[model samples]
Target: MAKPLKCDVCSEPATVHLTQIINNQIHKIDLCESCAEQKGITDPSGYSLADLLVKPESQSAPEVAALSCPECGCTQREFKKTGRLGCGACYETFASVVNPALLNMHKGDSHKGKVPQRALERATFIDRLGTLEDGLKEAISSERYEDAARMRDEIIELKKAMEAAALED
Candidate 1:
């Protein structure tokens, strides 16, 4: 009784559905037969997710070399010649020029590195330590010496535990 899904790219009646879960978020993509085939959905070996994700730019504009990053003053021509950017902001400024090369070189645009379990645990401990320190300051300002003492003791214990973990690693 439900209506069929439409293609995400072409708005046609979708025949193919792909769901991707990244960073605990669900991303759904619906593609019609023609669009799916054109995008190489049928052949896993030849599949290029970048082709579907990055829209083609207009070829009419030939003045891309004139483009420059507002933050670092790096020009497209300079990037093309040096193969590097002046600063972090140049990435966004020259994305149109850089994305195609990135797809060809890395086969993907994003980094998919795995975080170490210990690193995750350490990060959580650091965050909790910061929160406890903030709470201790608040308790002291509010004239609650007992609560402050308890938080201070907890903070010392957490620091010792974190140090022990680091030593174990």
Candidate 2:
């Protein structure tokens, strides 16, 4: 067979898959037959490829105009495109749209606060682990194997704490 078309969003080969891409990011839109089967999503009425590709008229969709602030009704496409907001309230106003877009653009690394406070604590632990890892690298470069080993232990302990806290969260 000829080369398959790559997914426009992920730039990966689009093998029995379908999704929505906006601004060079992908969102799970509709599952193809194969993907739905893989995901164990069986609709009683059954869904066709057309059902996935064609949005129904009854769905109240947001306006796709990039010129206006999706949250605050601010008309500034240039700032939005560049990923900078004009005001503090922009975060609150556009949070719904902004968070997901930011998460997708940043590869699921954006702060989504639905998580518990313990997750924040876990994150701090991860940060501390990172510092320890960095220190270990520096110590090793400076011929301080002893300090490096100490930092390695600290990092291991910190990582275990982070994992435990994450499970609790």
Candidate 3:
């Protein structure tokens, strides 16, 4: 078996492998999915190795080109080319594309920065409280009075637990 080729640009495991014979000479190019898409080699034109290997997920070139950040007017095509965002709003506007890239780059979507234990606990408590409150409202609206009462009790318990935790700190 032959050794797998890496992408010419990013060195990622090449999914798109192209071979061309010119002037009685054989030449080959290897490209990973992202680099192939970045180079516009994934266009479904004629025959290309990328077309056979990399399938686009949802958005086509036209749709991606059409996407633009409303705040800074940064086009998705520009973002793909530059790999930079124009503004904070671009993160939200281009989340679908950006999120996967972020995961690839950071290995996680959210920042897991070092936080004080108390702060982490507080944040978790707040998040749980908000979720319970929303569920409580939904239960009430749907006339699930029992569920609502249970959630309400849960919320009170959560508040008491948080209070005890704070007192300990």
Best lDDT goes to which candidate?
Answer: 1
Q: Tell me which of candidates 2 and 3 scores higher on TM-score.
A: 3
Per-candidate Cα RMSD to the true structure, in Å, reads: 9.0, 16.5, 13.8
> Which residue pairs collide, candidate 1?
none
> Which parts of model 1 have CA positions greater than 4 angstroms off?
1-60, 70-74, 103-120, 140-146
Q: Write the per-residue lDDT of candidate 3 for residues 6-83, one digit (tens) a residue.
A: 776567899987775545754466779998777677566644332322224344666665779999999766665554
Candidates ranked, most accurate by lDDT first: 1, 3, 2
Q: Residue 60 lDDT in model 2?
A: 19
Question: How big is the positional error of residue 32 in model 1, measured in Å on the Cα after superposition?
Answer: 25
lDDT of 3: 0.72
- Candidate 1's residue-wise lDDT over 87-154, tens digit each? 98887877876665455335476668988899999999999999999999999999999999999999
TM-score of each: 0.44, 0.33, 0.35
**In model 1, what is the error at residue 37, expressed in angstroms?**
25
Query: What local lDDT score does residue 32 receive in model 1, on the 0 to 100 scale?
Result: 94
Candidate achieving higher TM-score, 1 or 3: 1
